[model samples]
Each structure stands twice: as structure tokens, then as C-alpha cells.
Target chain A: MDVKTRKITGQVIFVLLALYLDGLMKWAFLNNMNTGEVMLIPQLMLMVLVMLSMRISDRRQLITYGIVFGLIYDSYYFGMIGLYTVLLPLAMVGVDHYKFLFVKANMGYEISIYFLALTFMQSGIYILERLLQQTKVDTMDFITFTLGPTLLWNMIVFFILYIPLANLSDWLVKYRRDK
Target chain B: MQKFFSNKKLIILMLIIIVTFGLLAVSVNIKDKKSTPPVIQQVGNDTVSIVGGIFAYPTNAVKNASSEFSDLYNTYTENRRLKSKIGELAQNQAKLKVVQEENKKLKDELKLNATLTDYTFVNASVLSRSPSSWQSYLTINRGQTSGLKKNMPVMSGKGLIGRIIEVNKISSKVELISTDNELNDKFASEIQSDNKNVTGIVSKYDSDSGDLVMENVTSTKDVKKGQKVITSGLGGLTPRGLYIGKVSAIKKDNYGMTNSVYITPAAELRNFTVVTVIKSSVSGEE
Candidate 1:
């Protein structure tokens, strides 16, 4: 498989992955938890995973994967209904637009964006939903108890992940151009 | 250093992303729309309710989609069975709406009012509690931003461990009634009053032991064993008549100060989360 085409296929796999991970656990959350109770606080888990995967490819492709992947993710797990589809595509577009001007963003910038992105995506929609009188937005201990761990965990994963993935992506991009 | 910058296709793609994000930023002026349609002003209002609640449309779509087969038969006859069950459930839901309205009225009439009513009670998790003293403290998950003022009461169940002494939005500490012996004595008198048919001072005694002593005992008062010991409600926290424990003794005191009265606590403090914030109800939005 040529690198470009293989990367395309990987995006499709990403969609399926988002579906399985978000869907089954969502089923559990829905069946067991009560109304107004938050089961899965939005985390950086999938967001970082998708963003990191982009190192292996290009901007157009990143969104192509993210949108396809996001549609499935939103469909399965969230009560917001269409949010993931909306948010994931936007995140991809954000990265594609700024990835170069920002230029890898260093380690701190990357992690900060990653953290800010997840927090804004999760809490932004939640605050909006709460204001609209849809779902109640809980900002109490959630900022610390819940948001802190998710960010910390994602940062740890990113540190472990970025260098290897960046190298791999560089290798693949070079190899594809040579071929 | 940046070899990828020379790629024209990448530059064009970045331009497209930048423009699209700008458009979306403007378009994302999301107002709350319930059951609204998706065309201009029409789009925001058509399906908000359906969108708000339990993604019912999606599940329905799943059922219909499963029955639809491009090649192999995906959904089985069991789908039909489940579909009918879903139909029955929908009918039942309409009936439930009426019952819920009726129940709300009853709660109001019961006058189940608590003392702390003038504050916003943020629902938070119980992180930890003190290990010693009946006047023990608990920690909650909310703090400063949550409007959890200091000395706010922590509560759960029908009057579980409460009495908030410290608070922040992200975390708060609570002084549980179990951690202090002073409140326990006051609570005992209240517990004993609820059941009536028995007499005793507000006191603390062992629950498991069979003997509970009574102060100011007149053999004529006829305080008998095995009588129920409940909250006397004199402490002004929980109301009178709440069950605390059963009386197991009728022994007299030597100094007339009272005997070593043994009384059991009502609740077994272990794994409880999700408490009600008993703030005073504002008059219009019941």
C-alpha cells in the first residue's frame, strides 16, 4: 500500500474505532446512570489520539478522517446527539489551518492546545447546553476532580506518544514522496 | 527544516481549513432550540426536544437501519418483537406523565421543608470523611465557584451525615454528626421522643448491646425495654421521630446524673454518594 492510500484506509479504521469505544461504553452509561448524572466526562483520550494520528498524513486527510470518525463517535455515545460530528471536524480544521503557522507548537504549545481543545469542546458545549436550559452544566468540583485527571492523563500520553509518532510520520511522508 | 512547507496542495488545504473555521465560528452562534427544523431560522427549532433528550431518534434509526439490508440480512425477527415492546413503552410513558404531576403535589403538601434554603446547592461527590469522633467531618466535590459557602450543610438520604463547616467550589469539608459526642446526646432525646411510649434524656449508647439506661426514671414512668429509640429532634437539625435505635435497658443511675445509657445510631455509614442540597425553596419555581 502506498503511504497516501494506506493513510486513507487508516482514517476509515479510525471511524470504526471511535464507534466501538464511544458506543458500547455509552450504552453502559445510559442504562445504568440516572438523568442529569454525567457518566463520561469528555476527556482528551480520543481527541489526542486523532490529532496525533495526523502526524502520519496531511491536512485534507486529517479532517477527512476526523469527520468520518467523529460522525460515528457522536452517533454512538453522546447525549448531545450531533456534537462530536460538529466538534471533531472543527478540531481537524483548526489543526489543518494552524499546524504550519504554529509549526508543531513545541511540546508545551502542543500539550496546551490539546488540553485547551478538550476542555473547551467538553465544557464549552456543556455551558452552552446549560444556558440553553437543555442539560444541567456542573462546574463545581468537576473542573478539578474530573477535568484535572483527564488533562493530566492526556499530557502523559502525549509525552510518551509524540516523538515516536512524529518520527514515524516524517519517515512515511519522506518514503511516500520518494516512491 | 520544514520541507513540507513547499507543498502547494498543503497550502491550499490550509487556506480552505482557515476559511471554513471562520465561517463555522460565526455559524456556531448556538441558541437553545428544542425540536426545531434545520432550515435557517427553521433549522434551530424543529428538533430541539428530540435532540435534547435521550437520543431517541438515533435508537429508532438503529432499529430501522438494522432491518434494512444491503446484502446480508442484518436485523432478525427479534427486531419486530422489540419494536412492539418499544411501542408499548411509549404508550406507558404518556400515562406516567400524569402520575408524576400528582406525586409532586404530595411532596409539597408533606411540607418536607429543611432549614438551609437560601443557597445554591451544587451536587458533588463525597471524597472522604473523618475517622474519629461522632462529630466527624466529610469532604464534598464542589468548592468556591460552586457557591458552596463556608458552614454549608452536607446532606444525603433522609437526614444522613451533615453539617458543613468548610467549603470551596472544587472541594468542601463537612462536620458529620457522628464525629461529635455533643450532638449525639441532643439527637438521642429527639430519637426517643418520636416513638413515644418511652422516656429518656438525649443520650448516646451502644446499639449492639442489650442494655440502655434511662435518666430521671420514675418506676411510675414505666419506661420498658425493647421500646424504640428515635431522634428527639431537640437538636433542631433533623425533625423528631426519626428512628435512632431500640432501647434495651432500664437500669437506674447511682448519682442520679443518669446511667451509662446505650443507644444505637440509625445509619451504617459506609458507601453513600449523591445527596440532596436542602436549600430553601424559592416561591415560584416548584
Candidate 2:
């Protein structure tokens, strides 16, 4: 009911929207089922989470968002648990831990952070899936086809969406300090 | 020893790794071995799917509209070609209806309840496709509540696409045929050639060429390019006579010991929103 709760609710909604968009964007456009070997996985949810974690100083809240959304993501999309469930929270916590290094969040700092997080989350998933025998793609092919394209595409998307997303997350997190 | 163990960050990192592998291993085992996921996971998936429908509907609409616009581009040529077949198609349909009636009567006389070809279907709109590479699954709206079960062969408008891998309370995941997963994507298929039908397992997906590779073929001698391939219904949950694709090419394996038949899948594997899950009237061994 208070301004703080409402702001937190807005942040959650923002992340939720990103979560759903990740799947929808893939379904609607990035679905290259037949011809292409290069795959581009939209990580808008990770982007949003990274942006929010940069601004939202509360480590507990960041981890909570990570675990809850990660669970939902794993259960809903991947059908197996732990890929997103573990990596999402860990990536957020990693962001939160090193966030003090940057004095102010800007396009450059946020984009680089997202790049690192995306690489970590994706490589973590690749390793886990490979170990489980869920996928047989070798490390070279994975880096060349899946990781490279996904990073390039997501970075471009981050560039195009950086202004709106960064502003929105900034507003969502800054209101508590204003009060 | 106590100081090293007491380092809080180190302890947390170890805990994270342990939990990560633990959850991943257990869930992967459950996915492979269990018919259904745990009850809590089912409830969580169903709830998320219900909310996802709101977003999915609009996206599906846009997809359909765009595909339709593309269809419009080729409507003229398609219509001209299809017009020539209209008369033959009508005759075939009438003959098919009569034959179906006579076949039903014969089955009734023989006291046969259901055959491999006897199947009913439930239609469900696709909610979303997993963005992951290895587990390329599409979450559909219908699930156990809609008389759906695991391993049901799902079809898009044209032909066979994939099979249901996971079913929740009201949503299910269909593993696409294009997935490179070594397990859980095989379909028993047969190519209809001039002399005899050659049976094979539609196994691996060739991502480079975008063709499905059918391995362990009985004999590829009679197989030729452009012949229709259908589910032979020899084993597994799928019923017989479901159209899979056409025989694209037959090539010998690397060692040249056996042959593998490549098929051009009939389903577009894209642009379609709704999928039909076929429920065979005759149940197979569980």
C-alpha cells in the first residue's frame, strides 16, 4: 500500500513483462527451427534483472527476484529445473556484489555488465546441459553458433532498449530514496 | 581449518554449486523417468501457462496474420495449381468416405473396436517456444485436463511436428522434431515406395540441412526421393498412417555399412500457432 511497496511491485511487473517477452519474442520472430544453425536466445529478462539489480541496493530482494523468477522460468520454459533457477540468482548476486565498483549506472556500464551476465548464464546452462547429456553440441560449435549469435543479438537489443529500460528501472528504484 | 570453513563467501559459493548440480540432476532424472513432474511443479507450470495465454493469444494472432499475408503473395499460383486438382480431390474424397463407411461396417462385423489408424485429436494453441537450443519445446494450452498424455504425437496444420514430453494440469510441452537431443525424439516411420514400405526410425535431426535423418532402416533399396513417409506405428505410443514427410535422400553412413534416409519434414516447424495432439483409440503397452 505504501510508495515503497508500490515501487517494488512496479519492478516485479517490469521483470515479469521481460520474462514473458523472452519467450514471445522467440516464438514470434527468432524461431529459426528449420534452416539456421546459428541460434539467438533472447535474454530480455536477464537484461531487465541486471538493470534492476544495478539500481536496487537490497541484496535480499535481488536474490529473491532471481530465485522466484528463475524457478518460474525453468519450470515453464525449460521443463527442467536448476538451469535458470540457480544461474539467475547467482548472476544477480554477482552483479549486486560488484555493483559498488561503478559509481553511477550508465549505458556503457550496464551494457557491459549485461554482456558478462549473459555469457555466464548461457555458458553455465551449456555446461550443465552438456554434462546431463541433454545436448551434444561441442564447445567450439556452441561458442561459434549459439553463444556468438545470441550475444550479438542480445547486445543489439540492449542498445535499442537501453534508454527506456534503464530509465524505467532507475525510476522504479530511485523513488524510495526520494521519500 | 575453522577459519577457512568460516569464510562466508566461500561457504556460500560451495553451497551454490552443490545445490545447482543437485537440482539439475534430480530434475533431469525426474523428467526422463517420471510420467508427470511433481505436483507442485505441475501446479506452478499450469498457473504460469494460464497467465501466459493472455500474451500468447495476441502474438499468435500477429503470427497468423503475417503468415496469411505471405500466403496471399502466392495465392494466385497456388490457386491455379490447386484448381487442376480440385476435381480429382473431390472424387477421392467421395471414394474415401464410402470406403471409410464400408471399413467401419466390416470392423463392426468383426467386433474390432479400434485400430492403429483410429485416432481422435485435441486442438491446442501454442503458448510459447523455449528459447533454449537443446530442449526446443513448445508449451501448448491443453494438458491432462484435456485428455492429453505424454508421448502423444502432435501435428500442426500440415503434418507431424513432435510429441508431448511433459503434461501439467492445463498445459503441456511438445518436444519439436528438430531438436538434436539423442533421447526422446525418435518416431517409427515407414517410406511408401512403389514395391514395399521400408520401415525406419526417424531419429536425428540434421541442423545444417534442416532435414530429419531416419536411421536403422530395414532396407533402403526400394526407397527413392519424393516418396511419402508416414508413421508405421510399429512401436511406441503414436498411431499408424500419420504423415511425417517425404523421402528427401538416402545416404550411406560414414562407414558405409548401413543407409540413412533423410526426410524433408512436412510441417513448416514455424508460423503455426495451433497444434493438434492425436489420441489413439487403441492404447499401446505402457
DockQ (Cα-based) for each candidate: 0.07, 0.91
Worst 10 residues of 1 chain A by lDDT: A28-37
Per-model lDDT: 0.44, 0.93
lDDT of 2 by residue, B61-109 (tens): 9999999999999999999999999999999999999999999999999
Q: List, residue by residue over A1-179, the lDDT tens digit for candidate 1.
A: 77867755554554344344332223222221111222333243354444554453456666665665554333222212345555666666665566666655466666666776777666655554344343322577456544665467556766887776445444444444666
Best by DockQ: 2
Clashes of 2: 0
Interface RMSD of each: 17.3, 0.7
lDDT of 2: 0.93
Error of 1 at B40 (Å): 24
